[model samples]
Target: MGLAGLRIVLVEPAGPINVGSIARAMKNFGLQQLVLVNPQCDRLSVEALRMAVHAKEILESAVIVATLPEALQGCVRAVATTARVRDWEAPLENPRTALPWLIEQPTQPAALIFGREDRGLSNEELNYAQRFIRIPTSESYASLNLATAVAICCYELAQYAESPEIQTPQETELAPLELVESYYQQLESLLLNIGYLYPHTAASRMEKFRQIYNRTHLQTKEVTMLLGILRQVEWALKTPRKDEKL
Candidate 1:
């Protein structure tokens, strides 16, 4: 289980040294793909080049994109890194809980997203991902440097990749992120339509739903059951009738 096709996306990285160091870390962990979105500094600057050292090939092959969605195209699973604890974001999971799924599922390539060093990922950007990761640290200084965060997550991922006991059974197919996302989208819309969630508090309420389902680690059959439940609820809400009270 090599990190052959996994993609690491850095959104709006402003520090060239951090970028280069991230490349070096990726090389250390055997990751190849590096994507940058709207980088503020020259990724190939002399400073970056010097820091990359032996990982210049990763730097040279890095794909630059204009936006986050464009950078995440073709990725089946995406995990966003964040330092702040937001009530509306999915529950922050560690790399240990998250990385296993990536290595276990070989067919779908996973993407790890690191936000800007200063502000971290925006609310909208966080919504684009199904899950969020938080590095456990002292509360006084919870935020970690971009390169350090990358190194920690990559190291955890590499450890899982090297271990053989973490292998997943072939019969228990993991549901694709797209399918799970669609279910969440439909669930949220239906809940909003039915008055269970209001516009003012919709995001936070929906985040609870995300956390519950993600914790389940839903399989294909489980997802089908959930979709069926949502469909029934939606149909009940949509079906209108004349005033014929029983």
Candidate 2:
């Protein structure tokens, strides 16, 4: 029960110092897997190296990817870190609610995603995650430094990772990312086709739907059920009967 194999992804990190600090903190908390997506600054720079100190190995071994999807390739579960409340996005939970599923799953890899230093993860990126985690902070300074947020989350994860209670029996199997994503895509297209959602307002409206379903943390069975319902509705709307009135 450790974060030794769990991946931590930083999307578009710009600060070398922050990168190094995160590596050091990861080492301190016993986390090893680090992933960076299209880094803006040299991740191996002197400033970063200096900050990493003895944890330079974590920095050196970090995988760099061209996009968020590539970084999340093999992860069974992924959580996104966000600061502000998204209008159409699902309600954000604390680290406690989200981390348990990760710790309990021994067979599949899990990922924790942190966004850029200047701006947090985009809605598209956030949509990729099954759960959203928000660190409680003062309203005046709701946004925390990227590294600080990472450290706090990492620490909380460490607590659960090291606990024996996290080894309990699994309750339900989560739907695969591909399956969930496909559902969203199909739902969006069906809605647009039926004029339920206009092209101009599709993204925001779809996001609200995403929030509602995601917040339920739907299992594979539930997802399949919903997909069936969506397909039926789509078919009914598209099929023309001879007796139907225009």
Candidate 3:
């Protein structure tokens, strides 16, 4: 169902073997979309192709982008897998619980993001995702291989693909990520102008604002309303008050 619309996004994957294995896992679970963001290794390398096996087509047709935002261009929903915990308000869920949410509806495109092999997603990259997933592992050896992580998540995603209970359609059309992102840029500028955020601290402060708005799942009109408010604020700040002329 929604598997068709799901995109597996790997950010800066450094190992061709891992990238190839991930492609195979995706194909095994009926996923067709693979997005590689600034990959450090060649997806078509001999090692990569060897691991991909019958899934070479997945590698051949994979979409390569320069950045995470570009990878998520038209996606309405995104979930990022992380290994580190931060002070943010977003909850870190496991694969089964969160993976299903990605494919809840088949109509719109969604994304599941994985980070670099050496280090997981940074806080800035994590901000682009509305949901976060952290796989549970043993206390002794907590780290997971990049390819292994993708396989585990893919298996869970495939399980949910056959289940009809979670297929309830979304009520409203959520705003495209591009629209939401534009609002963030506008809001940040407005905040800077009003001194709510300083030049050095804008990025961190905006992460909080992102978390707040992301939780609301704002629709297109809702985002438009917010943009209008920001525009009015910008205008109000530029125009002198009636008494200021004196």
- The top-ranked prediction according to lDDT is 3
By descending lDDT, how would the candidates be arranged?
3, 2, 1
Candidate lDDT (C-alpha), each: 0.83, 0.84, 0.91
As a TM-score, model 1 comes out at: 0.77
Clashes of each: 0, 0, 0
Model 3 ranges with Cα > 4 A deviation: none
* Between candidates 1 and 2, the TM-score winner: 2
- Ranking according to TM-score, highest score first: 3, 2, 1
Candidate 1 weakest ten by summed lDDT:
167-176
Tell me the RMSD of model 2 versus the true structure. Answer: 3.0
- Report the number of the highest-TM-score candidate: 3
For residues 1-246, what per-residue lDDT tens digits would candidate 1 score against the true structure? 348788899999999999999999999998999999999999999999999999999999999999987887766567888888786635788878976666566666678899999999998677657678888999787778999999998899889888867656574555666677788889888888878899999987877777677666677778889999999887876676567454
- State the weakest 10-residue window (summed lDDT) of model 3: 163-172
Q: Candidate 1, residue 84: CA error in Å?
A: 3.2
Give TM per candidate.
0.77, 0.84, 0.97
C-alpha lDDT of residue 242 in model 2? 75
Give, for candidate 2, the lowest lDDT window spanning 10 residues: 164-173
lDDT of 2 by residue, 23-131 (tens): 9999999899999999998879999999999999999999999999888876667889898787753668888878766657656677899998888899889988878
